[model samples]
Target: MSLTDIINAVVSLKKDEVVENVISEINKGTQVDDILDKGLIESMDVVGAKFSSGELFVPEMLMAAKAMQAGLEVLKPHLSGDATAEKGTVLIGTVKGDLHDIGKNLVSMMVEGAGFNVIDLGVDVDVEQFVTQAQTQNADVVCLSALLTTTMPVMAKTVEAIKEAGLKVKTIIGGAPVTEAYAHQIGADGFSDNAPGAVELIRKLMAA
Candidate 1:
């Protein structure tokens, strides 16, 4: 399949078609990451913008993200074992005492779709876990999610742990209660209220 076709698949949120054709194209020697960036990732960049502008909503954005992941799975085998060439490494998770993962899951998919090697620590992740895993993976970014007002403090504690450990992982925090003002107050490197914004913020942080 052509790269444009892959892009269309992502744009249309066709998970099955994208994964199938992407694998077919990969077997023909097209560069996997190029297929990813030019096609799926680029499509998701559009999805993100559409979502922010109210042109799309949670369900549509979630489906597009799912389609992108399907394509990524096809390329993952080819992507493995080239650690030195990765775009960046990231550690992401939802904070402890919060069982909700919809937002966290979406952000994880978007981050992986952007070609970062993501280490997902899953839900109910403790602050220490964030610090430990970021250090362990030598992650360029640490993304925290908390869907409830009560759980949002987990983000701050997570940040503190990273600071206390003297880790240089650039922190990004978001969820229902998270705001750019709150983010800045806590000294977070970045804050995103949505998945695409998260991905965009990561790109900016990496570029900086």
Candidate 2:
């Protein structure tokens, strides 16, 4: 089967088909990174565009992300260290005092689909945890998410702490209440309002 077939499977939300096709491609000696970037990652990029155009919604995006993750599971073992380093590492979480996760989960899946090695710290993550994990993981980017205005300040604190720690990782922030202006005011390296945009934001930050 062609890589487009796998991408179509993911976009159609056919998780098992994605896995089976991915394995088939691997057995046929297809390069792991090619399948990931051309099939899985590109599918999400399309899905994100559809979402932006009102052709798709949250539930549909979630299903597509799930399908991509299924394919990723089959390809994980074949991903060499050099392959991962090429995409860079990402450390992501909901800032302190926040329980929201839907946005964060979506970003995590899309970032992974975009070829990054993502370490998700889950919700209600403390500022110190962000710094500690970013350092421990040698992350190339640290992302914070918060849905509440109250928790927004924590994002700034986390960014400051990362800077204070003198880590070289770039910092990005996002969520329902977050904006590009807020990102700049808080000293974050980047901001995205959606999952697909999050992947793009991370790419730009890493490039910079």
User: Where does candidate 2 stray beyond 4 Å?
Assistant: 1-86
- Inter-residue clash pairs, candidate 2: none
Best lDDT goes to which candidate? 2
Please give the TM-score that candidate 2 achieves against the real structure: 0.61
Task: Put down candidate 2 lDDT per residue, 1-208, tens digits, no spaces.
Answer: 9999998898888999999999999999998768877887788878888988999898998899888878877876665432344498999999889886766876787788678999999999998899999999999999899988999999989999999999999999998889999999989999988777888888888777
User: How does model 1 fare in lDDT?
Assistant: 0.81
> What RMSD value applies to candidate 1?
7.2
What are the TM-scores, per candidate, against the unseen true structure?
Answer: 0.61, 0.61
Tens-digit lDDT string for candidate 1 (1-208):
5888887787788899888779878888887657766776677778877887998898998888788877776665565232345689989898999875656766777677677898999999998888878888899999988877899888888898899899978999998778999899888998987676888899899999
| lDDT scores of the candidates, listed in order | 0.81, 0.86
